[model samples]
Target: MLKPWFALCALFLTLGAIAEPSPRQMALFNNNCVQCHLRPGVGAPLVGKAQDWQTRKAQGEDALLRHVVEGLKGMPPLGYCSACSEADFRALIRFMAGMPAGTGQ
Candidate 1:
């Protein structure tokens, strides 16, 4: 009785914990990436533009992630998303590169 209810609650809690980033995280990504990327001559590659991303993507995902974390020629450290975790950086790279999430190098 109580055990079944507890199990169900645990399952739901686990699922919630593994769910995607909250709206706040999405907003952070948008605020940080969109501002620079969308503008021409910003040096930051525009999101969803394969041509803009090709050369960067050729550098490999690990390199790309390193650039985001450490900052490249024109990109700032943490890609300006100070609150972002490594996973968040990976997602952002994939999103910007126009690659599907979970697609590894």
Candidate 2:
């Protein structure tokens, strides 16, 4: 009966909920990193600038996590992602690390 429809809707909703980061993490990035790392391209743009992050990643994920959590030159602690959890930062790094440095601004 309608059970299939309900189940389908529930599945979609659950998937959607798990697909993205929390609003707090979003907000933090928006307020902080969004400036330097523009959405499509403008500022430094972290999404696809693999080169930009490659040097950092070379140090290893732990090093990158420490930099993000502790802060670095030109970047404040959490990179302004104040509310981001350690796990959130890790995921964010992994996502950014995958980007190719040559990605257009």
Candidate 3:
């Protein structure tokens, strides 16, 4: 009985590993952005809200990246990911923007 439960937990963990945000990216997101940005906030969910991101896509990736790097009116600069590299920032922004995980913008 315990063996089955352990196996199920292990499988779930493995599947999560293959999913979005990677460990590093996940840590970065949790630390910096989860506060105001709910998983399904009135604005958008960082995890996977395809339609919300569709509206943002029209603005272009550069605009999206710039918004994060520079900060918009309601958001603070870097959105608190100041330590994040350009590549990291790009990845994070793309992830939150509704693109599939690991899909480099």
Candidate 4:
């Protein structure tokens, strides 16, 4: 279970697919996304779990950002980070989805 997830994380890290948040982005994530993304079965995709984001990422950055801005299913608008701007949301989405730094703004 957890082993497979750990393996995937390692693989992504090796391939530079995992994105790291800046200190500012970290603040936003800590205040908002961590509450759900770091937990299991909370509806939001868990960070570092590539499979969780496979489809969403394939939808490309615009669609992902739209879902965040407009809210999708159990997710609230701006992912509850009302103080966040489009750039902030972009960074946060990349961080959680493990998208590479060069992609998606």
Candidate 5:
């Protein structure tokens, strides 16, 4: 009874995870960026909306990474992902900006 329900819930969670980031990246975003990113009018870019990221994207990955590392406007230093590596930030930025892979420029 309860075992079957738990199993079904686990299956859905696994599927959801599979459709997106690796578990580590997902965990980082969940704990850090999700606080402002998924919300409206928080002054941080909204995930999955390209327009929210276009101007920033045009600045190139290096600039964006610097902003994340150094803090800019509404973003705090390290964008609050203190545990995130440069590689993690890169991938997550592209994902939020909707840029095609390797096209962060």
Candidate 6:
């Protein structure tokens, strides 16, 4: 029983580790998202504003990704980060939407 419990704990720990973003991802977010998301009335949802992101989150991750990739409203295509990959977009969206990493999609 103890062996099984330890295995479960290890698995959970590994999963948690994998859920975090890399340093490059952090840089990408700081360089790109912070410019608009941290401000008000920029047409981008302010980071950490649950109410602002709630409606958008309800639209699902796929729809959000599409909007980001194609540009929606005042947001630019690829969210202005041409180097950002799909995973990067997902991580940034989760961060901005106030969802825990790996919880989006």
Question: Candidate 6 regions off by >4 Å?
Answer: 1-19
- How many clashes (backbone N, Cα, C below 3 Å) per candidate? 0, 3, 0, 0, 0, 0
List the candidate 5 regions with Cα displacement exceeding 4 Å.
1-20, 102-105
lDDT of 1: 0.69
Best-fitting candidate, scored by lDDT: 4
lDDT (C-alpha, whole model) for all candidates: 0.69, 0.57, 0.63, 0.77, 0.72, 0.73
Report RMSD (Å) for each prediction in the order shown. Answer: 12.2, 11.5, 7.1, 4.9, 7.0, 11.0
Residue 52's lDDT in candidate 3: 59
User: How do the residues 1-105 of candidate 2 rate in per-residue lDDT, one tens digit apiece?
Assistant: 454335435533644432344456555655666566543444343544556766766887778789777877766788877667776776556555652222221
How many backbone collisions does model 6 have?
A: 0
Tell me the spans in candidate 3 whose CA falls farther than 4 Å from its real position.
Answer: 1-19, 39-47, 101-105
Model 3: ten consecutive residues of lowest lDDT: 3-12
TM-score of 3: 0.66
Q: Model 3, 1-105: lDDT tens per residue?
A: 254335435533644533355568756866787665643454544444456567777897778888888888767788888778777777767656655455544
- For TM-score, candidate 4 versus 5, the one ahead is 4
Alpha-carbon shift of residue 4 in model 5 (angstroms): 25
Better of 1 and 3 by lDDT: 1
Which candidate, 3 or 6, has the higher TM-score?
6
lDDT by residue for model 4 (1-105), tens: 365446435544763646666678777877787777777888888777779999889998889999999999999888889889888888778877878776736
Worst 10 residues of 5 by lDDT: 11-20
Best by TM-score: 4
Model 4 bad stretches (over 4 Å): 1-17
Per-residue lDDT of 1-105 in model 6, one digit per residue for the tens?
254335435533644543455679767876776677766878788766668989998998889889999998799898789889999998877666756666644
